[model samples]
Target chain A: MPTLSIAELKKQANLIRQDIILMLERAGSGHPSGALGMADIFAVLYFQILNHTPHKPNSPLRDRLILSCGHYCPVLYATLARAGYFPLVELKTLRQINSRLQGHPHNLSLPGVENSSGPLGQGISQAVGMALAGKIDQAKHQIFCITSDAEHNEGQLWEAIMTANKYQLNNLINIVDCNNIQIDGKTTDIMPLLSLRKKYESFGWKVLEMNGHNYGNIIATIKQAKNYQKGPVVILAHTIPGKGVSFMENKYDWHGKAPNKEQAEKALQELRQAV
Target chain B: MPKENKNKSTRDGFGDALLALAKKDKNIVVVSADLAESTRVWKFAKKYPARFIEVGVAEQNMLGIAAGLALADKIPIATSFAVFSPGRNWDQLRISVCYSKANVKIIGSHTGLGAGEDGASHQALEDIAITRCLPNLVVLAPADYNEAQKALAVAIKHQGPIYLRLTRQNTPIFTSAKSIFKIGQANILQKGQDVTLIACGALVYDALQVAKKLATQNISVEVINCHTIKPLDKKTILASVKKTKKVVTLEDHQIHGGLGSAVAELLAENYPVPVKIMGVNDTFGESGTPEKLYKKYGLDQEHIIKNIKEII
Candidate 1:
């Protein structure tokens, strides 16, 4: 696979960030902090890193991507639409009564979603299962599980981590959006998830720390993760809660609150300028 | 006449059935939460080591992994004690498997007081109530070894989530290999009009014993083996209850949410018959032998006979 130019990936990430702002504003209710924070990572995954095709979402040989922190599904929905999994206009129906794009990621409804996830910490275990299945079949496809720094407070996450190491699931890649802000306050004030890198390393996983907003860094770290075959890999990507918009950046208040019409215009302007 | 009854635990039947199914369908896989020998999944593990997964004391992860395997088109049978799988990891089963409509089979062994010596913590009295309430989940509590084995095959063939409850004690296997088994169909073992006895799991044998005793006393009894708790066999149950007008429901689980509650719910809405639910009454079981627990909990044949007399 030819590597995508970093400049092209950055432009794609900016467009995804703009879409996230627009979708959340249209929906009238959705998370913004983590979704905006994860734009670069999502852009890198869908455009550069992941071995997947939107045309054949259910292809047995396609790579699997599971979002453990499904509250930030706007980014995923935008990324999938931009990748042609569905039409970009369908993004307006998010969280509607009969919309396929549920407030959380629902696999049965959406074609590109690998697992339905609303409750935190469960997607990793599902990803572990998929990775283990890949191992059993000796398939070359990889499984990537995206989780939140706040979600690691769940005991099931550690349980899944242990199982991944026990099975030596080198095919599994776990990405933690270490944006620090959660629903109530900073993750440190809420649960204090300090020493996150040491935690995964102690669990026998190969830990990679990178700048989540840097497309080049995100792609390079994922490439590094794919090369390591000893056990599962966890990339702890440090990012601002809201990366593009000035007022929302690093603000815990914006963790779950959606931007208003004016705020959405401002965020979109900033995103367009950044690109 | 009933053929010579074999004495075996339903867990053994599950293990044997899973092994046989795995042989025919390579997609069949076993996922255990550190209860391989206890839940009898060790047989499959020993036979097909690569196909068996040991999640090691993580019931939540076990269900999640099974759901993942199911999504990948592999039939995964996740085994653990009843209290742990549906009891400890019900949230996982609900969200990961049922809500997602994953083809995962959850086997909860050591159901009811038949868990015996392990005491209240290990027993799964509320498993039926919890599992049956979830939509898209099929709950089955087979009567004995043969029925348990047959129920496994039926659950495996079904396309969605299923909960198969088994017991630890070696109960009487009255159902023969030739006895037909279907997912939501009830099997009528005896025909009578004076009263009806609806039982599930290990208590089905006890209901049969009480029916024989009631016969000599000139009280006719109809016995129905209701293996599938969810999707209750309304056709068979209503037919029996309409004729008898007096019903007795029995199970090894609690009286609140097990077979008794299911029958009462059905009867109240459909038939409105005089129903006597014979089961463990709003209490937990202590450490004791299976026989002692059954007697103390009012699940023995004597209790069924007495309840039938009162209801009649």
Candidate 2:
């Protein structure tokens, strides 16, 4: 597969960020911090990394992506549309009564969504099961799970972490969005996670740390993590909440709050000027 | 003529059927949270080592993994004690499997006082109540070994989330191979008009025993095995009750939310009949022998017979 160049990927990520701001503004209620923080990773995953056929979303041979933190579904919806899974016009009906784009990711309602998730800490475990199935069947498809840093507060996350290493799931790659801002305050203030690198290392996982906002860094780090044969690989990607929007950047207020028309305009303007 | 009574735990029947189901369907995988032998899934784990996944002492993760495997087109049978799967990981079952519409078969073994000396924490008296409330989740408590085997076959073919609640104790296997089994359909073992005896799980056999004792006293009784708890067999239940006008509902679960409450709920709205709900009455079980626990908890045959006399 010919990879998207870093310039092209950056443009895609910018376009994705714009869509996130637009859809969240239109929806009137959604999470912005993690969605904006994960735009670059989503772009790299769909365009440059994932072995998926967007046309045939349920193709048995395609790779699977399980979104653990579902409140940030705007990022997943935007990325799927950008990847040709659905039309971009459908993005306007997000959070509407009859729209397929649910407030939380519902796999049965939409195509290309591997599993339904909204409640945190379950997606990682689901990815383990999918990865374990691939290993048992000797399938080549990989399973990637995306989670928020604050969602680690759930005890089930540690349960999942233990199961992944215990089974030595080589086909599973976890991408953690370490934006450091949760709903109410900073993660350190709410609940000090201390060092995630040491935590994963001690769990017998191959830990890869990289800058999530950088397109080149995302591509390089994910490529390395996928090829990792030791055991389960968890990539702790450092990022800023609400990246590119100066007002929202690093602010925990935007973690679960959607932008109004004025804020959306400013965020879109910044994204358009950069790419 | 009565069917042969095979003494076997419902958990063993579940394990035996799973082994056979896995043979035909290659996608059938067993996911356990370190209760393989106790839950009777050790056979499947031993026979199909590659197909079995043991997530040690992690019920929440076990459910998530089962939901994930179902997404990948694998029919995952997640096994654990009733207190854990629907007990500890109900949210996972609700959000991951039930709400997601994943094809996950959850076997909650050692239900009711079948957990025996494991005490209150291990007993899953509230499992049916919790699982029955979840949308798109089918709940089953097969009576004996044969019904358990047949119920699993029915659950596997349903293609959605189904909770098969099993017990640890050996009960009388009255249902034969030829006995008809269908989801949401109850089979009336005997016909009478004095009163109706509706039971599920380990208490189904005891209900039959009490029905026989009531017969010699000239008090006619009708016995119905309500194995499928969620989609109550309203047709069969109402038909029996309309003739009798008095009902005695029995289960190993608390009288609040198990089979008894379900029957009372159905009858109260449709046809207000005087129903006596016999089981654990608004309390928890303790550590004791299965027989003593049943007797003390008002689930034994004598208590059931007494309850029937009061209702009549």
Candidate 3:
């Protein structure tokens, strides 16, 4: 497969956002704010960044991706479906009883999911393990772990941060969607994350700051992270809580709210034109 | 019956096996939580720097790091005190290693009262119970140094989450290096019919001594080294129970949820044999020598003998 260019990646991001909006609308119960917020990063990773094959999801040589913030699973599910990991039709059965697509990302149930992440602050640690495993196996494959900035409040995330740094896990790439809106209120009011970049940097991680919604920046940062051979890399992506849709973007209420049929149509319409 | 035996710590076996495994397969990585010398993973750490990760003083991170390494297809053995592995970073172990079903070996050194002076804080009396409860987890508390080395090798070969519970203080080495060790299969150390003594960890040697002592008294006692605690060998247990209606379970862990409880649960559900559990019976141990703690807590050969008599 040819590597996708920045422009092509942006187009794919727009399509993924379309899928996320439509999937959530069908599920009638899913996270939208963080899903939309992570759209661009997901696009870049699936289309260009990761060395993966949808045909062989468990190929030992393929780069591993773990969705730590599983609530934003709609985005990952949409990306994986669109990437031909499974039929895109499976997106409709997400969160349904007995469906392979669980509310949280489950590795055993779902192909291409490197780790199961439901409770906050677990995926990153699992990803850290994957990266360490890759390094040990002498595999060139990297581990890309996407997490929510709000999950930073969890002590386990900090524990993972220290481990990743201590091990000098250069093969691991942790991307945090720093949208600032959590479930209750503003992240600052709930719990201030004084400086995530500095915190990770102090823990011996190579830090990268980028606009999460910017396709070019996402590609550039990931490329930069690939070049960094010193230690683990954490990309603090500044994104809107709800990125594309005008009404839902940056709204705390949309954190886990699914779009109704009418709301879904409106969300898709707004997302299509904006991107 | 001979009382004094050549003593060897299970942690030493872990250290030796890890180094040997690393020599054979460079993919075998050992991660320690600042107890390298204590847990004996330091031997591997010294030989294989690339495969060794020292996550200084953080059990949670040690587990997370080991899990991450396993995900990448490397067999990682994470070593720390038992009190910390299952006791402290249990959630991490469950979520990262067991739940994900990663190929990671969680080595908990200095388990039970055998950790000695570290006392209740360091004595992981609950490791077996806690680790066994987690689904898809391989919980093995090997009896002696030979079993520990074999268990480590076995864990490396198995493609799933494993917890190798180790001891701090040196205990008697029961099985010879040539003894074949397989997970989920009980090693029958002594054969008899009067009663069965099922035990694991440091207590297995003690059970063997008790069985020998009971044999001289014309009381034939069966001694079973119940090494793999999670996948408890029900066939051996049930078969022994058929001959000997009474059972005495010994462990250096808490009597409530350790090997004793696992055996009792199985027997209660299937055989309905009378069982006397010999362990730290529902109490925390204090700062004392391992020998003193064992004698006080009724975990020594005498204690096993007494417990066996009570059950009989």
Candidate 4:
């Protein structure tokens, strides 16, 4: 794979952020905080690192991407549409009645989604199973599970962590959107994670910590994580609750709330100026 | 023919079938929650170590992991005692497997008080109710070893989620391996017109025994083994009920949501027969031998015979 410049990656992340804002505004109801927080990581993944075909979404050899924090599916829907998995016009039908772009990604219902994941903690476990299956079937495809920092609190997540490490699933990579804000309040204030990187290391995983908003760091660390062959890998990416939008950044209120038309315009303009 | 019978645990049937199934299809995997020897999955582990997963007594995680494996297109037979699988980890089974429609077979070993010495904590009386309530889930309780083996094969081939509730104590092997086994379809072991006796799991044998005793007194009884409880064989049940206006439903589980209630629900809506439910009546179980518990809870053959007389 050819190396991408830091400037180019940042420009792509800004475009993804604009799409997130626009999609949420069109859908009229969706999460904004985690979606914005995960824009750079998502950009680095879909555009640079991940192996997929937009034309052949169900290719057996394509790498699998699972969103454990399903509430922020707008980011994935927008990213998939922009990546040409489907028409960008389909983005307008997100969360509407009988729309393919449901609030949660359904694997068979949507173009690029590999599995249906709405209930938390199950998606990562399912990803681990997919990665293990790849090993069992001798496939070279990788499995990337995107999780919320708050979702890690679930006991089932630890079950997946233990199983992934026990199987030594080297092809499994986890991206944690560590933006700190959750539905109730700040994750630290509600229930402190303290140090997530150390937790993964203690569980026999290869841990990588980087700035989630920095496209260069996300791409570099993701590449590094994918290189190790011993056990599962996780990138603990630090990010603002909402990165580009001034009023929503670091605010827990915007965790699951969608931006109004005026707010969406402002957010898109901010992203455009930043790009 | 004096009802040809022998004694063997239903878990052994599951064990024998699991090992045989793995030999034919390497996709068949066994997941145990620290009950390999108890649930008889250890036999599979000893033969095919690569296909077995021992998750050490975490029922919830076991169920979730099984669902994950199913999503990856692996046929996972998750084994645990009935009390734990559906009794303790029903939420996981409901959401991860049934709601998602994963192809995972839950082998709930030691179903009913037939588990004998392990007593209430280990014996699962409510498993049928828990699993039967979920949509897209098929519930199967085989009578004996041969029936269990055949049921295991059927469960493996069936799409979506299926729960195979097995027993610990040695019960009579009434049916041969050649006996037909079909999911969501009941087999009538005996034909009668006076009254119908519908049963499942260990109580099926007891129901048959009572039917024999009733025949001597000129009271004819129909014995139906309702293996699949979710898609509850309503056609056959209604056919039996049409001939026999009185119904006697028997099971080892509680009469409320178990087989008895399920039958009553069907009968009330479709045929409105006078039904007498014979099983545990709105109570939890306690520590006792399988025989003692069955007798105390009115789930024994004697109880079935007495109930048949009263209903007739």
Report, for all candidates in order, the number of backbone clashes.
0, 0, 8, 0
Local accuracy of candidate 1 as per-residue lDDT tens digits, A1-275: 23468898888888888988988998899899999899989988988888887889999998899898989899999999989899999998988889999999878998898888888888998999899888889999999999999999999899999999999999999999998889999888999988988999899999999999777688789999989989999999899988888999999999888889999999889888887
Could you tell me every candidate's TM-score relative to the true structure?
0.98, 0.98, 0.93, 0.94
Residues B148-265 of candidate 1 have per-residue lDDT tens digits of 8999999988999999999999988888888899988999999988999999998888888888888998999999999999989999999998899999888888888888898899
Model 1: residues >4 Å from true position, as ranges?
Answer: A1-4
lDDT tens digits, residue span A111-191, model 2: 888888888899999999899889878999999999889999999999999999999998999999999988889999999
**Candidate 1 chain B, poorest ten consecutive residues by summed lDDT:** B1-10
Clashing pairs in 2: none
| CAPRI docking class of candidate 2 | high
- Candidate 4's displacement at residue B275, Å, is 2.0
Candidate 3 chain B weakest ten by summed lDDT:
B1-10
Question: How high is the TM-score of chain A in model 2?
Answer: 0.98
User: Among these predicted structures, which one has the highest DockQ?
Assistant: 2
Error of 3 at B151 (Å): 1.5
Ranking by DockQ: 2, 1, 3, 4
TM-score pick, better of 3 and 4: 4
Considering DockQ, which of the candidate structures 3 and 4 is the better prediction for this target? 3
Tens digits of per-residue lDDT for model 4, A1-275: 23347777677778778888888898888888998888778877888888888898868888889787788788898788878888888888988998888887776578887666677777776787677667777889899999999998888788888888888889999989888888999898888988888899899999888998766677779989889899899988899988889989999999888899999998888888887
Per-residue lDDT of B1-312 in model 2, one digit per residue for the tens? 267676998998888988888899899999999999998889888899999999899999999999999988899999999999889998899999999899999999988986799888888889988988889999999999988999998998998999999999887788886688899999898889999999998788888888899999999999998999989899999999999999998888887788888999999999998999887878889898889898888788889888888888
Task: Provide the global lDDT of candidate 4 against the true structure.
Answer: 0.84
- Give lDDT tens digits, candidate 3, residues A1-275: 35788788778878888898888888888899998888888888888878988999878888888888889888888889888889988888988999889888877888888787777887887787777667666778888888888899888788788878877888888898899999898899899998998888788889999998777787888999988999999999999977778889888999988999999999888878866
Runs in model 4 deviating more than 4 A are A1-12, B1-5
Residue-by-residue lDDT tens digits, candidate 3, B155-226 = 889999999999988877768787889999998888898898888888777777777678789889988999
Chain B TM-score of candidate 3 stands at 0.96
